[model samples]
Target: MPDLSSFPRHSWLRALRQGLSSIESQSLGYTSPKGLPDARTAVSDYLRRTRGVLADPQRVVLCSGATQAIALLAHVLRNRSVAMEDPGFWLHRMVFRHHGIEPLPIPVDDDGLDVTALANTTASTVLTTPAHQSPTGIVLSPARRTALLEWARAGNLVIEDDYDAEYRYDRAPVGALHALAPDRVIYLGSVSKTLAPGLRLGWMVLPPDLVRPVVSAKSLADTGSSVMDQLAFAALLRSGDYDRHLRLMRRRYLARRNYLLHALREYLPDATVLGAAAGVHLTVRLPDDCDIEDIVRRAASRRVRIDPLSWCYTEPDCAPPGLILGYANLTESQIDTGVRAIAAAVGHSSQVVPDINGKVAPDSGP
Candidate 1:
């Protein structure tokens, strides 16, 4: 989730007003499940410019959100199980299961999903977050990226969930994986991270072959996404308001992330922070013996909420103890208070090691 309080309400309202004033009455009747033409074109232009996605408006299908896009794909790719990252987004697993498509869990290391493990699976389709792995925040390495695409070229399909790739703080965001193999990769993205989840706006840049079937599934699911909303978004994109809003949010989120990093350094010096270069959240690896459930309870008692990393794993008990903390929605003061509370909860459970300077050392990962 992004900082919902900072949603571009004024810009969106202006777009909506402009869109409503000019929209044809026929457009209000019903729209193609592939989405309105203007909207698709706008999305295509934005993605190509920012993420290096090889998107053609003709191949772009708009849906309510990434959730619906997943559901539509599940429906289209019926009877085929899909490979997923072990510590990936749990909701995606649930959506796949709901459509009776079982998900095969592929292990994720520091370089993102293990493509070798994925290739070993019988599944022909795989869902991945290559730009920034969910929960873990590791980017797919170049070698793994090449391997994944090669696997795709071998009659397999890769679903690239390019979620939250727009918020990199330390450097420019990575290019979408779909850019390398447009025909083999299905790129998924949504406004859930940048603008607001409530907008329920998302897009799929599909392989030419999957477009019609997925669009048919989308039609059966909701006839089509809200046309007015689509037009409003198109207007927003055309007027450059969307890009402006993203620029503002990036600076805001970066400051929040820094504050959280500082808090962690001051309060939990023994913890190791991973994937802090981008995204709204970062992962903190706890000491081996720390009781993560107990930490959760302790933090909750102090009015601080944190997600246990185990919840993202296929087998929760087997996961290493850690916490996934989001600072995007918190103020600096709130972040400090929350970190202090978490530190107090951790107490003496964390085993601290001194560096050469004899000070407790803090560590970070790329």
Candidate 2:
């Protein structure tokens, strides 16, 4: 079994210190249904300056996290079909199921989501990650962006989940979709990826028509997120600590990414690594002979945690076979040892299923 543990970091300590060191703290009480004003204002300013979201403090609905935002939107936009990238974050698909909304698995290529295909569907709402797309790390083509916005203008609600837009290695990250069509795109983001996942802080920039309904859903969900944390986040953002953390994280993840690639080439050269363009995790496709499920089990048995490629799919989708390697939690030494263990566990053996569906010749081309 491969020893594939996650990347490790200490971002939460910084935020915790910041939170604990507040000069005068308020009571831990129910937050405003729309979220604390300062938090919303902070997020609005961050999006404008960082993500280029054309939004006001009034439009930012702070939620428990991006997942909560998805659920809230699913509830508010009932009966309206929602479309998402097929090999997307599986939790998003589950949220739609729980809310009685159909999560249409729209196909994603190297160019990003097939916006034309999404437009051809009967969905009323579309969920997208335009900046450093998840699972496949491909930037959405500019043509697709224009087409999707045009479709949204023609009467489709585009829920933009700017989940992991902060880290970009190749070039400066692209601007937000809401900046171009604020009236049609509902922008969502969270500190889960930036500060830490434990914080559970995320915000949504709802369309004018969605503001009330989304807020109502949020009010019912949990009466809003932690007020203290929200205020603390606002302080962090206003103080420029949040952006500083992002820049710091980008440098760290970039190094980890380089290490993983080097280790793979030196260790598992037969493996194909994709989606290294950006984001916290990269996808590495295994040869067809690899028993993905068995590989996961073996990795776990070896005391390493790895997410299987198939785990992200509810329905069969066009995702190549690979594991989503999150290098945000493990150190380089751990990564090296883990990948070597993975190579050992996988052994020089390919567990190819006896079918042409997923064939991986031991010596294959990229």
Candidate 3:
């Protein structure tokens, strides 16, 4: 067998290393079910300055991770119906199901979720990733944002999954929809995409009505995340180290993104790269003739893993023949090698690579 150890590790390890070196101590005790008070306070300030959302520290509930936050929120809203993006984060839907609330489908275009389609869906809660819609890599349109806020005026709740929210590189950054309407939106963010998913650390800005129940739910779920990790994160945020580390990661991931774009052009023809700005991964859609599953199997055979976009959808029809390549983990050279392997295995080109480099906004192509 060939040596398969040459592959690069995912971004999680790198984040863990950063977290360890920056804040290396383990307090190892159980934290508050409502999360670290100081951490919540700091998060409130951070959101105010970063995303323009004015949040109450007391209203913030910290938990194990974003997924846990979602689960807890679903539990709290069990009586209410749920609405989610059609090609939304599948795991989010799974959590809703586990809690006995099935999210209604909301299809999306390049401009993010279809707010118009949401008219008839009866729900007091709607989950969405607005900063950068997953899979499609599109920002939510301003009109849709307005409409969503309008929907919220009717007492609808928006679970804002700000996953990969800080990684923007292309157009001007999109302000948090939560900021536009805090009471109507429940904001969820974590170190999963930013620092490390393993930390199992995340926070949620709950609606006033749901705060107590959600906190109780969290307490019942796991009591809380690690005290030391939460404290360390608080210290890191206070010390500005988290921002510094994010700056470093931005520079690093941007370079990797460029390399991937180049690979698309050189190694594959009739291919388009999308979702480059502000996230760890980008999706590349191949032409119709390409066998996506075959390409995936081929790439895996070469000892590299690439996620197919179709896996994210709940609907029967897949969007396109594509793969979601997580560039944040791989170095530039590894990206070149991996893309080359994928291209060669998929009957594309081994010799050519894209001289073009960039993140495609919504409407360009999937």
Ten-residue stretch with the least lDDT total in model 3: 1-10
Q: What number of clashing residue pairs does each candidate have, in the order they appear? A: 0, 9, 12
Q: Is candidate 2 or candidate 3 better by TM-score?
A: 2
Stretches off by above 4 angstroms in model 1 are 348-366
Global lDDT of each candidate: 0.88, 0.76, 0.76
Q: Give one digit per residue, the lDDT tens place, for model 1 in 1-366.
A: 689899888999999999889888898888798999988999999999889998999999999899999999988997776889999888888889898987999999988899999999898999999888988889999999999999999999999999779989897778888999999999999998888888899999999989989988888898999897898999999999999998999899999999999888877887899889899999999888888888899789879999999988888989999999999988998898888877766762443333333344443221
For residues 1-366, write the lDDT of model 3, one tens digit per residue. 011222123333443354455542442455568876777888888888888777899989888888898888888888988899877777887888888987888888877888878867776678899988877688898889999899988878888998688888876778998887888899988877776666788889877888889988888887887766666677667667677777877777777788888877777656787788778888787877777777788788878888888777776365667788887777777788788778765663222323223222233221
Q: Tell me the RMSD of model 1 versus the true structure.
A: 4.6
Tally clashes: model 3: 12
Give the lDDT of residue 61 in candidate 1. 97
Q: How accurate is candidate 2 locally (lDDT)?
A: 0.76
In model 2, the runs with Cα more than 4 Å from the true position are 1-29, 316-319, 351-366
The best candidate in terms of lDDT: 1
